[model samples]
Target: MNGRSRARALGVLPGPLPTGPLNAITDVAGVLVGHTTIDDGADLHTGVTAIVPATVRALPAAVHTGNGYGKLVGSTQVDELGVLESPIVLTGTLSVFRAADAVLTYLMGLHPGELSFNPLVGETNDGFLSDIRRRPITERHVLDALEGAHGGLPAEGCVGAGTGTTALGYKAGIGTSSRRLDAGGGPVTVGALVQANFGGTLTVRGVPMPVEELVPGAGRVEPPGNSCVIVVATDAPLDARQLGRLARRAIFAMGRVGASYSHGSGDYAIAFSTADPAPALPDAVLSPVFAAVMDAVEEALLNSLFMATTTTGVEGHTSHAVPYDRL
Candidate 1:
């Protein structure tokens, strides 16, 4: 009976725009999400999450860094080339190298005899909750996550790369939400997936949450400056530049959710589209896309808090989920 529900399901934080069928990032056609959780021991509370774009190959993309306080592997190339060469991976901070190498290895197996591939991997410091020094993640976990990726309702909170993450003094993890736009041409979908590990005031529907009162000893946990990795996907046929613009709106949404934009926070948004060769939308129509992203991101961040359950890790340090009664 420890099941947790989404925010909208309880009416605590309904987003502005109408959601796609699933209301999750997978609602974007062909986009897939998968995770490999590794919480084997008191100290090993970490894993990997993978997002595989529809193209099954390189796709036009962009990366926007709200704060450059992270070890984002293979980002410079994405910024320069404006194209994502591999499926994006998320994991712990210290394990970024392994995650990147694993992504590259998987791509190699798919396109054998192909060399020099760039892998995009994002991470946050799960060290506070898990024994990060052990580096529990492995290349196999990344491949498993990638191979298992699929489109549909995604499993969020306390899973995958979010397994050991804490946010706003709560046990925040993976959260995803999607918004659909009916802009005369056709219905376009924009989805956001987030690793919620940073710190903030924790707001829902414009009201600030009292994390300290909600959780026992919540005030003892550290404050902002950890990190958050937001992966956005759309079917709008946007190019690298437009995707970068769409990515930036995610930070605004983060602020809305109570992020302090602290120096230690590595806030990044990686956005791309499945419809390649489909031209980028005119700037005139891009405003709605930006709006959609902000709405979806805010809702997604709340979902992370609502869906996650209390978790106890190394040294008996427990990250309590926002108490259900408070909502």
Candidate 2:
């Protein structure tokens, strides 16, 4: 049976796959998610910052996977150091600059009586539902999301970066899932969290679940494209190339759900592990370690698809929930 068909027939949501303790991105331990949504004005279904912290500590090591096709600030430095020392930020497309600035300001306020800051911010296009031109993300909003960040089942649907998002011929938003892997000896956790703003016909395990069949009024603009921003976290030991390989496999899972990766889509993935850090001093060679990245990435993509909920955005545009009953 197709994925959706199977889900509908059994009356199940796909995210119930065998998981770790929390069945969420937080299962990885030390990871956290936070949101800030704005719907004050008509047709303005957008707002400010959502921070995804790499670790519970204020600063931790990080790395970026897919840096092209979208505006991601501070990725270059992350690549060089292989450590993310800032909170990950997300906002509407045009609000990236403002969001980045706000993150910087928020960082300065993080410590007591200290003021020095540099933050990482990523974005997706929400122009259709949000007033992208207004750049509504503010410093206070960024701080709130960061301050509120916690480790637990992250609030999904019309919240955070996914507040104005859609996916797979349905009203999609922020979704998360995790998997536990037996790498050689002990168990390692791998998790995925996504801001699903992409557009496409729904095809679950090969079933034809297009926009026309489900969300009728939710047609895309000319060129017919959508984008997805995925953040993968793991405790596995992997280098940059391995992380990139893991990110690439995420696209394959997207295809399994029937994503076309249309021209206008910003299909991107960023993956990092808090495992052993590479050597810093000269002449210190690091041994290659590759174990659970691929498996984790595959499961993570499915989680993003399965955990998402339906949504409504700008000008009365609404996307339906995945027809669990139809599956």
Q: Write the per-residue lDDT of candidate 2 for residues 1-327, one digit (tens) a residue.
A: 113221222433333235667656788767888888776546666655454655523232444333256677777766665556677777777777878887777666565576645577777777665666777777777778877888877766556776666666665556666667655355667777777666555665456666555545656432233577777777766655556655665555566566656656777666666666352212121111122333334344444444555544566555566655444
Collision pairs in model 2: 8-327, 9-327, 61-84, 62-83, 62-84, 198-227
* Model 1 lDDT per residue over 1-327, tens place: 248989888786455689999999999988899999998658888899999876656688889999999988989999999888889999998888989989988989888888688889999998878888888888999999999999888789988999889887788889999999864377799999999888777887778886887665666365333899999998887888889899999888898888877889899999888876366677788888898999999988888878888888888888888877785
Worst 10 residues of 1 by lDDT: 216-225
Off by over 4 Å in 1: 223-225
Error of 1 at 264 (Å): 0.8
TM-scores, each model vs. reference: 0.96, 0.79
Candidate 2 wrong stretches, greater than 4 Å: 1-17, 48-67, 110-118, 215-225, 278-312
lDDT of predicted model 1 = 0.86
Which candidate gets the maximum TM-score versus the true structure? 1
Report the error of model 1 at residue 33, Å.
0.9
How far off is residue 135 in model 1, in Å? 0.4
Candidate 1 positional error at 263, Å: 1.3
